[model samples]
Target: MQHKYLPLIIAAALSAMSAGANASGYRFGSQSVSAQGTADSNAAEANDATTIFYNPAGMSRLDGMQISAGATMVVPHSTFTDSGSTRFTHTPTGGTAASDYVPSQVTAPSFYLSKKLNDKWTVGMGMFVPYGTKITYGNTWTGRYALSDVKLESVTLNPSASFKLNEQHAFGFGIDAEFMKANLGQAVDVPGSVMALAGTPNAAALAKQIAQLGGNPALLGTAKDAHGANDGKDWGWGFNLGYLYTLDQNTRFGLTYRSSISHQLRGSTVWDFSKVTTDPIVNGVLQAASHKANSAALVALRTPETLSANVFHQFDAKWAGMADVTFVRHNRLGDLDIQFPGTAEGAEVIRQQWKNTVRVSLGGNYVYNDNLTLRAGLAYDESPVKNAELTHPALPDSDRMQYSFGANWKLNARSSIDLAYSFLDFKDAQINYTNACNPLATACTGNGETTRGTFKTHLSLIGLAYNYKF
Candidate 1:
């Protein structure tokens, strides 16, 4: 597709901003097999057969029919304090707002299942979310022109199989069907006086010219407002490869690789908002112009690739331990492309300068009596987006640590229930931007402003598994 200038500018604006409070954007990946991994020494090592996601090759060690399902609900809070460098001249909500930011809460959900077929093969299917986030700010927010709210969601269906080649080795493979959707909104500055000048068919033309001169502080009288509305949903496919090795009667090792998937989002972009509310603009144009309410834009978002290795060790009769390390090629996130329709010249735009991230987890389980078991785990995940360029509200990202606890209760013989919960703590990070943000501007100035703060999250999970031994 040919690149369009306007759409690229908008796209660049959207990509530079890190999604704020929503997990749909940059939260930690969830675990559905929370029970199996929650148990003993293997607990911190391999955890359940769900290790297929954590370590696919590990599927070779399971016997009989093993099915696992669960979900993680995450709640996040964020705060921002502006630096002296950034300054807002006016706001629709009134006054020169100082120190702008918002806080958010949401639930990120996920689940999975697996079964062994004969002695040589095993088949499994899992349902889970891969990416998403949500961010919202008060109307009077200082950076209103830069951001307001962002929501993104991506889910996946994975079907997998494994083969045991010998007592010491096994291999497995899985294919992923991914579906994703996104919603974005932001505020922009337009001359309040232009509203009166936009009376005739010249509204669209005038709106374009005004947008070009928007960066001029001396010309900026009162802050007139506008919003960006876009939602894109589509599907893509990818694959996972895994291997497992048995070192001894009580020890096992596994590794897995998840390839990256690229998504092209085709959606509508709407620009709507009055030049001013009931409150009159003190200077500049007072008449608001009505332009085409909608436009079209496309976004190509990347899902990073991952490599993980794990070790499981069983000790005595009641305890097991497990540990895992994951490396993700998030550094590829350095920039994202946004495409516009053929009619919209300069179609492609790039945003963000993301870096790579890594994750590490340790867990353990204890067998108490015969029908009940206890589990616990800890993990740390790194962030790809840095502080300075962070813009979008949908993907509020930062490095985080997770502490999880769960258990299984067996009923009769073939039925059982699992319960799990996780606490996530995100390090506080800062954001800085200014009028220079408008890609259409030439001579944009004002110390790009800055905001300081952090975020915290909580997640909960509940599941049921049915077991049948042949």
Candidate 2:
């Protein structure tokens, strides 16, 4: 567990670069219980207050005051098998393959309240988790250097208003207040860094120190139980707009747009070397590194914007159908850059270069009786990560299909309950990522170490919501 001099360098790198993307795979898609039942395709048919999050314009079609509260439980599973992974020394970084790095269950919650002021005015507020994810790949995983643990979460509060232009048109706008929290973790290959430091001025001194701790080449791939991590939080602002156009009582269309948000998270670097420190070398290195650093770290982050269109049609007295198409401008997060206030380390970067993405869904509802309705839906989700080489373990995202089912039970004139279940089937994805072993390197997928593998993953969601009308 004792280290020589490289842990200090990796500590600085981890502190500066504290952000990464988890994208569609971990994007907290179950925003509403009602919407989840329809694979989020019922935007034009917003029947409850949750419409405030999807398409506020639909609020114009509601009666009086209404409220909705819900929560969804996400269950995920995954396994990764290594094919060919090598380190900065071009030696095999042999370690255990990962399995179910993400937790078995994660809960996402939402709330909404809407009020109809008059025939032409409607107002509402909504709170929800738009993006969230947490992962732990163990210390000895094949891709430990690239990533071992990652936790990121965001919450949004939206205050919205809508106006009914006439029986045929409505418009809505909302302002968003978002909060973000992030934690990033990885391993610092102590033995492997011996090679990365080959030409550095401190090379000789470092090698002498390592040799004192039994410099063993066999320890190259055998990572110590050492783990490094950093954390930060911030707040950002954005806005959204929606429009609903009614063709007739039985048919309607909806359009919505959400703006992007920019955030700067400021934090100081924190390091824990206890697990890797039985010798005084690690402590000495830390003290020296501390004297030279005079700055806090800052991570710049950008959330993508999105546009969507939807249609709802009534086929008969007992049948209805809906569909939705959405565009996600993920390219806005092409890269994550971090800087130190008073250091020459320049900037550390994780080259995501994510591309834009699209999602499509279709759903249907059957009115079984005066108080019950059954729903079923299907959807396709695309990943913004286009190149396999860019794939990293922090976010095991990929293309997938979603199948959903649910029911709505009207309890009385003023109350109802919604129940839903959904399953995501992801395509087997490949990981061909390379992680830089040092801070001075510059490459989208790293140039020093490569982790090659195939990943299999999937998820399920169960949600429940209660709705009330005044």
Candidate 3:
């Protein structure tokens, strides 16, 4: 194969990767241990350096210098049970079985540092992962032609400053430098491709030539699968702002907004046709056809913006309450457009049609004594994915309920340790999608084979942190 054909092969692979899934559009909720303890209602409490992420304005309330470091272990399980799925040719493909497709565990970590520079000003910095996930299915699964493996990872560096404008108000601002990497893999249906190609005028002549070359024409159109993979990385920038108002020393309100960032990912894709057939002529024709359809692809992706508001009230020195409501602009992710520069094929647009979502949380903290504090919280999070038809295997997301509990152990006047645990229960979802085999069809239902199935997921998270002041 010529070197120029390599880009085309890779482009096709990248297209498959772009369709993989992300939970709640790839939002991670474990930015702070204290926040997680209260189901992320700490936006107005701002009791530690982690305010750099929740509500930067809270930094103005900190005295001296403080540092907080933590990590959250996320363990998730997802299983898929097929209902009655088949290949495009209406052949049974064994999609009506049960399998586990999600990774067992992943970790999200965070670190923050804040310094009171003056009587009314504070500065802070943080490092964290806001979006990430991994999903994999068996190679022989019925949906192998649609998806097999996908992984997305990201990290952000944030620097922020807060100003105490008066006794009642404070404001904060920050800049975000984020980096992301993605990988995807899927099986390619070679036999299906050959059958589809048979519609061309030259197919008959090609078949004759293959027969003369001692090739079996019947085998050319038989079911066979290949493999394709792609990986890409990019960097993006955005900003966040926050405001805090104090009704009294015991009561406060907070609001924060994080802007969206856009990325143009650069990557390579590769295809393996070894499993297609051993016939050189057949393989050559397939490779040439694929090369003509592929190109060096550039994919554009965007991270959604977020808005959150919270209230923190101190009932007394020993007891306090907090509540929060957060909005995610997931609708910003409408579709992924993959472009092959200088090619007439234009861009491959994959429809996502995601919807915006919200999260609501309620919690309380009780200071048992100078040495210990206990916390508990509950939350409801909406999924951006609307229905089963649009749900992809890479991200079988659903609405979720989260229950959390935590504690703070005071080591000294200026030091403490925080621990928290949360259980996330996701509603079971059903998927009934088919890869469109007919080019003129408006939906997958009538144009191709259907992969009908059900998905179930559950997640557990444990967080630990050490906080200190100087």
**Per-model lDDT:** 0.53, 0.72, 0.73
Q: Using TM-score as the measure, name the better of candidate 1 and candidate 2.
A: 2
Candidate 2: global Cα-lDDT?
Answer: 0.72
- Selected candidate, larger TM-score, 2 vs 3: 3
Best by TM-score: 3
Model 1: per-residue lDDT, tens digit, 120-171?
Answer: 8887776666665545554456555454565556677888888889988888
lDDT score for residue 46 of model 3: 92
lDDT of 1 at 345: 29
State the lDDT of candidate 3 residue by residue for 1-470, as single tens digits. 11111112221211111122222556676689988898887789999999999999999999999999999888776677777766666666553243656656677789999999997899999998877766677677877655666677778899999999998999999999988777767666555556655777656866776788677666677636666667777788999999999999999999999998877777666667656777766665555545433345467667778899999999998899999998988777665555555444334344456788898999999999889999999998888777877665655677888899999999999899999999888889777766543322222111244567887877788899999999
Name the TM-score of candidate 1. 0.77
Rank all candidate structures by their lDDT, best first, as comma-separated numbers: 3, 2, 1
* Candidate with the greatest lDDT versus the true structure: 3
Worst 10 residues of 3 by lDDT: 1-10
Worst 10 residues of 2 by lDDT: 1-10
Clashing pairs in 2: 1-276
Compose the digit string of candidate 2's lDDT tens values, residues 1-470.
Answer: 01111111111111111122112634567689999999989999978999898899999998999999999888777778899888767788778878667687878789999999999999999998877776778778888877777676678999999999999999999999987776666665554654556667666665455567655322323324345566667788999999999999999999999988777776554445445445545534532332323346676656778899999999998999999999988777655655655554445455567778899999999999999999999999888667778776665568878899999999998999999999887888788876443433432112256878887877788899999999
Q: Regarding TM-score, does 1 or 3 come out ahead?
A: 3
